[model samples]
Structures are given as C-alpha cells and as structure tokens.
Target: MLLPYAKPPPGDADHALLPPRSVPARSRTGEGFYMVRLLKSALVLFIGLHALFYALQNIANIDAAHGALAYVLSGADHAAYPATMFFKTGNPLLAWAALAVVLAGELAVAFFGIKGGWDLFAARSGTAEEFHAAKRSGVIAAGLALLVWFGFFMSFGAAFFQMWQTPLGTGSMEGAFMYAMASAITMLFVSATDD
Candidate 1:
C-alpha cells in the first residue's frame, strides 16, 4: 500500500533545497582588517617612542665641547665604555665596528617595522591570494625586525662583559640580562599579534 504522499530523499529533484552558504559580511571582514591595522599602528608608535628615548638620552649626555665621547667618558662608570662595547683605551677600530653594527641593526629594525605595517594593511583588505602574498611579505619584514632587535639585545651582554673586563666600571651583569629579558617580552608580544 502506497502512502498518499511520500517525501523525496534530499538529493531527489523534487526535494526543496536551501540556499548556498553566504560568505561572512564585508563589514565583519573590514572590522578584522581595521583591528589588525590598529595593532600595527600601535607597534610603530612604540618603536618611535623607543627611538625618541634613545636620542634624548644621547643628546643629554653630550659634553660642553659638543663631543659625545668626552661627555660619556666623564662619567665614572659604564658611561665611559665605547657604545660598541670596546674599551676606549684598548682598540679604537673595535669600538667603531661595534657602533656600526648597533646602528645598522637599529636602522634595519625601523625600516622593517614601517614596511610591515604597510604590508599588514594591504593583506587585511586584499583578496585571498593578495592576502597570502601580503602575509608572506609582512612576516618576512617582521622577522627581520625581530632579528635586528634581538641582535642588539644579545649585544648588551657582550657590552656589559667588556665593561666588566675593562677598568671602565664595576657592576654585576644583572642589568644587561634584565634589559635583554625585557626586550624578549616585547618581541613575544609582537610575534603573538602576527598570528
């Protein structure tokens, strides 16, 4: 005995169908992109602040003769050691080389951060293909920035060790270690946001 009406299987032509799943609203996507941009902006602002602080510290330490080294050496402690961690009395070339390395790292970090911000913004608004491309670019830029910062952070220990070995100063290596640790914390935050 056949029922008066029998329901067709889902795949049957007679079966009613639901509409295809819709992509998330554009507004939602835009909001996500905006949040990422906001984060990148904050990171850039932090870098600027760090740069300003470094510049101010250097300027404040300049001597009356407008000689930076003179002012630094006048101080009775780590102040006298060459910025590159070399002893002023030991080897001038080593001091210069260290300074150059530090400066180069700083410059690279600044450039990478700026480029990363732009790339992140682009990835946020772009199509899937474009987003992936931008993501790769941003990751590289960010990785370079991290590398530069880490190099300087590690150098702090060497600088402090040089200071300790030289007659330039007497202090525990705790300060240098602490600084490196703090920097690591900042790097961790930056990396976490990248994901």
Candidate 2:
C-alpha cells in the first residue's frame, strides 16, 4: 500500500507494479565515440581540402592539363599495348572535355566533403542522433570521390584511355588506385553509425 505522496523505492516490487513505467534510453558514449567523431571530421576535411587545392591550382593550366591527356593518347600507338585503338577519334577537344569532366567531379568532392566535415564539426555538441544525421553529406561526398577517382579515373581511364601506361602521371593506374582506396576507406569510416 502506498502512502499519500510517497513513492516506493526503485527496484521494489511495489515500484514494478506501477503500470510498467517508461524511461527514455540514455545516450551511450561507449568507447572512443568522441575519438571516432574527431577522426571522421579530420580525415574528411583533409581529403576535401587536398582535392580542392589541387583542382583549383590546376584549373588555370587548361592547356598543360589537356596536354597530359595527349600523353595518354600516345599509348594508342604502343604496339605492346593497343588499348588506345578503342578510340573513335583522338580529337584534342574531346581530350579537353574529359579533363573538364574530371575537374567538375573534383570540385564536387571538394565542396561536398568539406561542407560535410564542417557540418559534423558544427554538430559536435549535438545528440548522437544529430551526429548521425550530419553524416549524410559526408557519405555522399566520399562516395562521389570514390566514384570519380575510382570509378571514372581508374576504371574508365584505365580501360578506356589506357591510363595504366603512364610512367609519371598521377592518373596512372597506381596513383588512381591509391586515391580510390583512400576515398573508399574514408567513406566507409564516415558512414558508420552508433550501434
């Protein structure tokens, strides 16, 4: 029996009898929650800034940049590797078009990744739910980078343009593979949600 204004102690059978009370679940910090957030924000921002600066610096050098593509086209002449025979027309304008496409994707990765990191950092004090919500942009940004560097540069460039033949180019198979891997790992890390 309960007295007026007197509640039974928690864990008491009397307390249990009180219509199955509801309690909001407390947020779980678990291990390294903050550290994971820090890592995510920093890595994403680094990728974004790295790509942004590289693209911005190179955008002004269109002729030189386009010329790099010309070097790849030379692989078509390689008797040891006739991959370039896949080309219907090795027009210089088409080369510039490819470069433009790459630059656009880079700009997007830069913008989305940086902005996503910023969003995560800004929501640092928010609840775990808010933090999870903030990851959407970062995920999209990282995916975009993976798609461009891995899907486009490595896949299309290697398969279509014979990018693997380059000895010193960053878009060479080796370098593109590295960039793609980095973006993929970052994307996976950023996509993690509290379990």
Q: Per-residue alpha-carbon lDDT of model 2 for 105-132, expressed as tens digits?
A: 8899899889888988877656778878
Worst 10 residues of 1 by lDDT: 64-73
* Candidate 2 similarity to native, TM-score: 0.78
lDDT values of the candidates?
0.45, 0.74
Instruction: Name the top lDDT candidate.
Output: 2
> Largest TM-score belongs to which candidate?
2
How high is the lDDT of residue 94 in model 2? 74
In model 1, the Cα lDDT at residue 82 comes to 36
Evaluated against the true structure, the overall lDDT of model 2 is 0.74
Candidate 2, poorest ten consecutive residues by summed lDDT: 22-31
The predictions' CA RMSDs to the true structure, in order, are 8.1, 4.9
Q: What TM-score does each of the candidates earn?
A: 0.49, 0.78
